[model samples]
Target chain A: MNRIAAFSIGAASGVVGTYLTLKEREDLKVEPKVFKYGRPDSPVSFHSYSAHSLAYDRARKIPLWVIERLSPHDIKKEITADRHRSNFQPDPFVSPHYSSANTDYFNSGWSRGHMAAAGNYKHDQKCMDDTFYLTNILPQDLDNNIDYWYRLENYCRQLVKKGYSLTVISGPLFLPEERDGKKIISHQVIGDNNVSVPTHLFKILLAEREDEEPPLLGSFIIPNKPVSDCPLRTFQVPLETIEKHSGSHFLQNLQRNKALDLCDKDGCKTISLNELTLYRYAQKLEQATSKEALEKLWAEMESKAIKLDKHITAIYKKKMNEF
Target chain B: MNRIAAFSIGAASGVVGTYLTLKEREDLKVEPKVFKYGRPDSPVSFHSYSAHSLAYDRARKIPLWVIERLSPHDIKKEITADRHRSNFQPDPFVSPHYSSANTDYFNSGWSRGHMAAAGNYKHDQKCMDDTFYLTNILPQDLDNNIDYWYRLENYCRQLVKKGYSLTVISGPLFLPEERDGKKIISHQVIGDNNVSVPTHLFKILLAEREDEEPPLLGSFIIPNKPVSDCPLRTFQVPLETIEKHSGSHFLQNLQRNKALDLCDKDGCKTISLNELTLYRYAQKLEQATSKEALEKLWAEMESKAIKLDKHITAIYKKKMNEF
Candidate 1:
């Protein structure tokens, strides 16, 4: 039997002593970040420089969980996009270290998806580059990466904009895929490095209100496929579903008995930038002097907004209502 | 000058003492609901038979506001439609009241819109019929009554289904309309009863969680026009906007420093029952044994879901994601 033991998660605040432990598999070594809360007599991490902590699984070469404390201030920074591929450096912090090479993605159809998006940590150049660490990269479909997943990332940012300070945990799921009536733990591998390609990726956003009310939780689980066609809400699952699949618990200490009602299972219709931009343009068209021009613009926007997919249309309907 | 003084809102629990008063408009008598909270030290009115309370404006023969406590259970009870033109009975509760006759609506090119919809109080037959009172009725556009306004009503019910206990305040808005740089409260009066025909109607839905968090507020202001061409979200306004126009406050006692983040100002694409039903049917067809049949069904559902209004399509996208 594998040993299943709890290790105290160290933090400057003694109150935040919750643990993230394994169920039964001890083969993969687990290490929680030693959180250094700043200032004396503060019951919480009030002024800590670091906004995130990670527990990596050296065996999988991916993080077990990348927990981040995101605020509006963090996302407010403007950072230049690092479009040029940077060097994949191994963190000296991990013992028995293995560096993931950029060559591992050579000729592979998958895009190097960021588990913790670079856009999120644009607060500082160093923090932005820290997201480039090989462990944060997961094999993702290009369409899913830039489109479907991007919508969720935008929503998280929007939540922050709405004055919510979120504690987000993102990870990959290598659940057993059923084949011919049998559960099989099979997945694709890339390069000689044997970097495991996850079957699914998930993110759990725990949105905490400033008023000390129970947190609003939103969990998204999407297959490692082209998800641009689907709505963001479609990937929404109950928090319990994520826990059941990953064998991991999140915010268990802070959540206590609070209910997670943020799934919005009925879902939201997420819109593309083009669509949103078009809608904003349409709003401007409402003030057109020429009746002909206004009608023409209305007709064009109407067709696009009306002919959209149900989910997108739903989002469109919402936008239309705002008008 | 009209006296606008706050009145004591009575209930067993002192917490239910939130007042609803008017601002110098004593011409229309205002009497806020005196909520009767049940035993067990409940801060709110729970386990009470009545779903709502109203403050009717006797002079206008319309309600100043109709506030209702809505839940899934309140909407679950089956009540036969009150068709065949029910009599417009006068609410005896109001002082120095005069009964509004059905003849007032005769030859009027408008439908009698229920401020608090009849469908909402379907829990009991008497309660449902109570909505037919003349004070609850307003001169509404036929298209707006049956379509645009109906969509907002359906959404309120859906929110209740999602575990929200909503306090809904529906009223008529007689805001000053501008004509050649002139602000005028120009409105039509129908029949001898002098029933004021409002240019627009508004509803404020404050969804309170069971856990006692600050309520989520959604304010909608729909024009009394052919709103069938308009989406439900197009009418969404801020809570502050409603207060500024009406000169009435809401949730003042319950909400302290907490920000009202419930308004999806950009808007959510809320769905219609027909759209939702069709989407569910589409999901079932995915497992069809016959490939040709499955393809045919998919094509049909796809076109329907895709071609829906932006709001419905957004909902459709969420449903599609699940599959």
Candidate 2:
């Protein structure tokens, strides 16, 4: 019985090896060019392909088990890390660690700039926060990260209109350090509490349109200063707070109504001063500085008349024209 | 007349502006993911396809001009620099320039290695040599290049049975600095004194066989030690002497036979014996005392009327048995 069992094991091993060899041979036969380096009987085969092709193929071939395990956070992390590995530096504004004193450029007075605006993401914090990975960080002048940055953000928003989802990662390759020292990392102070330094940042927008081929990647480097504008920005609010406050429900509503297109649907126009007062009271509750202040603000707003439909229309129209 | 010329120029400018705007819009339509980081507007696009797809799509989208503009030597340089960049921290066998000279082990020891080994590719020198660049350099041990590095010098006689034109490049990645305390670019020594170091090597085989790919790349990594009873006297000789003594006709014949699989067929096959000879003679010459000793060694084999054909047959049989 033992002898028979040994024989069976040997036979199974032989069959497995033979099957693997045959499969490899078939693959080589189908595309001889793939084995241009010559088959070495190694487990891993090396072949050269373009970055875009690799990404698409990988996305398709990812095992179901792997996909099942991935969350929105996981997907965001993987995309963020991959972008960083490919040389995307992080934006400092959204990164809490940058403001930490332990970093190389603590309090260096440089702002972390995001090529993708936080608001355009409907203020999703995880998406915004992913831009804080070091690989996504790059140095930018303060003015450039603030002023022209908004323009570029608007440009990306415009791209969404044309059925293209923009995935932008941009930053300076090098930065001047302390006037004369070898250029080191830089940092930004956030809300008078935390300091941050970002090395690289990226924003990836998955396509919304059905007919268009989704953009699988994108990157850019901010040119050296002396030019008028680099056009990048740093977010004022923490991405987490923004994401929680904005909520997925609000985003869904915006998309459904084509709020991005700045249009309103179902004109059931009505106004109630009491409703307006209630909305202001809720807003005050969300933004109150202290418990006492919050109570006072809410009481003041609640006392006033509230209007709903008229206010919504006015705000919606104003946002539509702004875009 | 001046006013009419000014008007015509203004009309042309307007047309140009219209064209530029249209181009910008087309660019904006591109997904942001496709853009490379440093070069936002670069025209070059990269894509990877499966070997099968690549085979089917071949109208040779890679332009002839582009291929022509890039020399194998230039590519080698780029590849070498990239290897260094990727492997900034050198490993056990591969030492950095700063670390190589500091080691005492390499001085008294000889490694039993393949002059044209596949593993040497990570170092870049093996692939750059002209002789080892040939396809025929096969599974050689350390003794072959160090002590018997000469016995295998005329192994080309064994190649005829394989029914392929073998191209080989063999040379060293480093030439010891002549003066103490002087720095040397260990990877740049392609040839020296009309000859080149032959420690590093590569091989390519061009044969029309059912299983053989038209172009193939392989290499070997010779050990840093000497051995006794060097089974084969595969020695190195001075490349210049190999060409001058072998005669130009012999060299020309080899080139013509191997020219069928040029990297860029349309480009000129400008053979340089300088690079080829260095690679060919590296192992043999390293072991030989002088050019006379090398020639006398070959003459001895000729006088013996060596059964080169029989030896080649035996080698092939041996290789087949391994498989």
Candidate 3:
């Protein structure tokens, strides 16, 4: 692989591009178009494209994990409208892999869910279209897809708005269940080719900075079913658990000790919905367009943020002590 | 949750039964009938009964994992013959869990294969019958069920015959597949309720001895597809991989380190069928009953065992050195 010379476009500090490192290329079974920040020779930092950063399982025709990096520029990208419904198609790049066809989802109760969410790539039409590749989607429960999982996706983007460069890996899992006395794969399947419904969906978030400190990791494993608007922390698990389930390790190329070990044990949080009232408020703040509306949203946001911050701080403190 | 008194029957040294420990009882979302060996107050060891040792997922009426232990005496019991084919029924215990019915497999083109092998418990009618529960079954590839997976099950029992007490945990996994460039659950479903077919099945074995050394762990994650009669080591994966995919931890209750870390890296075994020819010989010897037949089987077994012994010893020695 040749190293392409660094080029800047539009802004002085632009979205940099990098391909998979030699080590990652050797480790991955399928080739992916991985785009990262800085020059081809620079130390690996945050990534922007997830078209090929996935670990593909050829027998199953699904990725074990999909990774994407987001920054403030990504969250503010507004050049394109959401045309995911119209533009959904098979990815032209991954041939012979035999990804699921669009017709396979017809009449199936599950909604076509995104793994590398489209909203995170709305800045470039090409990037947004890339997210529509069938390789980036999983069969998700309708209620969980639109209401809960989507909210979690937005929250990840919000963190980017708060200036944190993050690397996110999201995927599906088929956990075992006991029937008579033995554990077996027991879940619903849709269509003739057998599009399996995921028992659970997991997302792992890592905060990376230029500093020497270890990255702070937050991992979650949520059931792919209707769930209440409880605090997101309810589903947090350890990075080790997510790594084990996906059969691929994350941030392995960046060797550093874990700064915190979260949800390594039982008794994860399950707080009341009242604690997440600010989350609902944040949704409304996003829609405020006029000057009057902006002023009113800011007033409401300030009041709710104070209350929610204290509540969330207490919850995080207790979880920290538990860890 | 009450502690029932231990009971013994038939032999002077009885098969001791212990239910799910209080710790497992608390961690499990649904109750299972777990039976452990040794005194009620002692730490959990090799489990004999899996009725409650299962980790059940209510969304999908299936267990995450099942554990069982066997002895030579336990294997020799011939009180009952295999009645699994005719005695299948829905588990009455996992109500609201809504396990699949027999009709689901009627025309699905897949076999209702048991996660827990019935032959292992054939000596006792109740135990053998328990293996027929629909919860203990999964939709498996017909050829794989009858040939590949079944052979692996017998091999575990063969290990028991060699005087090694083992804690065996077997479960199913739903791996992700990409369709149209999107990672989705891709597998076949059967019947009206869409009982899903698993992409793979995993079995983890921990050989425990009454010695100071750590237990030997053997893990296999086999695809739910047609397989050849090759060395079983071809499918070996790290125990950590199984735990991650199943979302449940084994041997967590038992505080000990692994005797050997197997398959944690690349270069896992993919030996030829010639090395495993003794396995076929053993299967033939199992069918021998008459004096002439036993003599003929013994003669053939001696020849094959000698060759297999050298081949296996060399493979094991290489593996041990690498570990």
Candidate 4:
């Protein structure tokens, strides 16, 4: 038994020894890097809505500094439209009948609705109208949007009674074009129950108060309906689309101008020159470019559009023909 | 004003019309598939440890259907091994240490060390140790590993008593690597904090359990010290050495396998097969592959041979080197 033991020990050591010897002659290596998890610099972008839709894209663009600077009055302003436009269009870019104006007509029969009731903007119409931005909107059930949404609004009101005010945004999650090919729509769901809503109707909410509550917000809702067939009404445009439309790649540009700043603030590792160039071009488009150059840029953007119109038409035609 | 309203309506319709026309032209496309979150097909592995320096790993490569039909005791026996023999290696593999093995050690030290205390063997020990098959070990603090780790162990034990035996895996947390750009280690931390450990140290007890309560079978201790300069211990093998010892393109093989897995899982969304393959190959070389692999897999697996040798070397080096 002892001899067997010796042999086993020798064999084990020998195997290790052989490995070590080979490693010494050549080299064996292992490299592992540490990764940190926190809030991602960029959240996943949604693509069922339009680039011009305020509900889908508003909160992301609002700089943290800007949000910090905002006062109750500023929040109030977002809920209401500007006094100059009394008879404003529900949605500026698409017609009411096209499904963009009201998302209730789509397959999901849901719309991006605000938990922080748009009606709350009665105190300031400008703020309420600004809430119309695609970013604030979320896919929501019409009944739930009007009812439970109102309940949430009431909850916010109760908070205000206890000396709290909120600047909230909510929307439905939309499946990106990438996901559509799989025949499954990527909708947003909250909590363990997986309460889901149409991908187009996703929303985010941001609320703050003067008291000592640890930021009473961070939630999303998914309504259970298609709501409309019009792409703009039913989907939130992808961030890439907005970048293309604005002619400015925000992440790339931000990194270039402030490499160190980006690292310290956002934990970004590096920035590429392509991003810098895009940023510069965006600046030119915003302030320095000629109309012709801007037109050319828009034309370029047009080519890259994901073309939701085709998807809607195909589905509509199929449905009509089937009926 | 009415004309503007009409124009707005017309503009909206035109936008919808254009979208429909674009859809008819097959411009918008849906993605082909959606990604699922959990692994549905992978087999479970188990790990076990004794009061002494014995650890065992056992996993069957048999299909899941066959394995699931076996009795728990039969499954346990299939993976068990006597720890005293040098060649008593367990197939699959087990973590070399028990959660409580180093608790006494930590109590004497300044810092507390933490480890994955539960959710190992498909939430079973046997499963966890099989997972320990060289691929899962990371450099960790002894104090934290033992002290906090013991606490976590106790918590899991309590949960098991309460009929909550489900195992959960958490933290692919990224920790900083050595100053040299060699490797990064991902650490997994487990166990909930609802249960507390009894301590007879300097601090006084705040509460006591009622006599009717079940004796607290599991309790943990926190380490005295929390941080250190070189918190993690490396196996100390160079990358080049592994390739030479294994006589195989070890790193390349690992990378290829990992890349394939990633492609299958993530839909080729983030990492390419080529990149993953390259990364894996690099990792095999960094850890002294031949010696470590042989020691872990074949010899000293069920016995103290490797550890005794290590102890002898430490003593001899201390005396001889000093002389």
By TM-score, the candidates rank as 3, 1, 2, 4
Candidate with the greatest TM-score versus the true structure:
3
Q: What is the full ranking by lDDT, best candidate first?
A: 1, 3, 4, 2
The lDDT of model 3 is 0.54
lDDT of 4 by residue, B5-31 (tens): 111101211211323222222222432
DockQ of each: 0.01, 0.02, 0.02, 0.03
lDDT of 2 at B71: 19
Q: Which sections of candidate 3 miss by over 4 Å?
A: A1-52, A77-79, A84-86, A210-212, A261-323, B1-323
Candidate 2 lDDT by residue in tens digits, B1-323: 00000001001111011222112222222322233221111111111111111100001011000000111222233334222232211111111111111122122222323333322233244232311211112222344453434323233223322343344433222112223432221211111110111223322223233345543222222322343332221222333222111111111222233334332321212223333333334434345665566666555545755433454334334443443
Question: Could you give candidate 4's per-residue lDDT for residues A1-323 as a string of tens digits?
Answer: 00000000001111011121121222112111100111111111122221111211211111110011123443343334443452222333322222223222234444555433454545555444544543334446676554434444444444444444443333333233323222222333322111233333322223345544333332233334423222121223333332211211122211122222211222211122333234334544454235565656545645755233444334334443442
lDDT of 1 by residue, A1-323 (tens): 21121122111111122322222223323321101110001000100012344444333445555666677666666765453434455433332222245676767677888876776766565556667666567767787787777777767777777777776778787555445543334456555444556778889877766675667767888887776555676787876566444434455455435744565521344666565445455555645556566556557766765443455445444555554
lDDT per model vs. reference: 0.54, 0.26, 0.54, 0.26
Model 1 misplacement above 4 A = A1-50, A77-88, A94-97, A264-269, A273-323, B1-323
Q: B-chain TM-score, every candidate?
A: 0.65, 0.21, 0.64, 0.24
Number of the candidate with higher DockQ, 1 or 2: 2
Q: Could you give candidate 1's per-residue lDDT for residues B139-238 as a string of tens digits?
A: 7888778776777787788788777777777877655544554333445656555566677888977776676566676778888877544456667787
Estimate, for each residue in A31-57, the C-alpha lDDT of model 3 and write its tens digit. Answer: 111111100110001111322244333
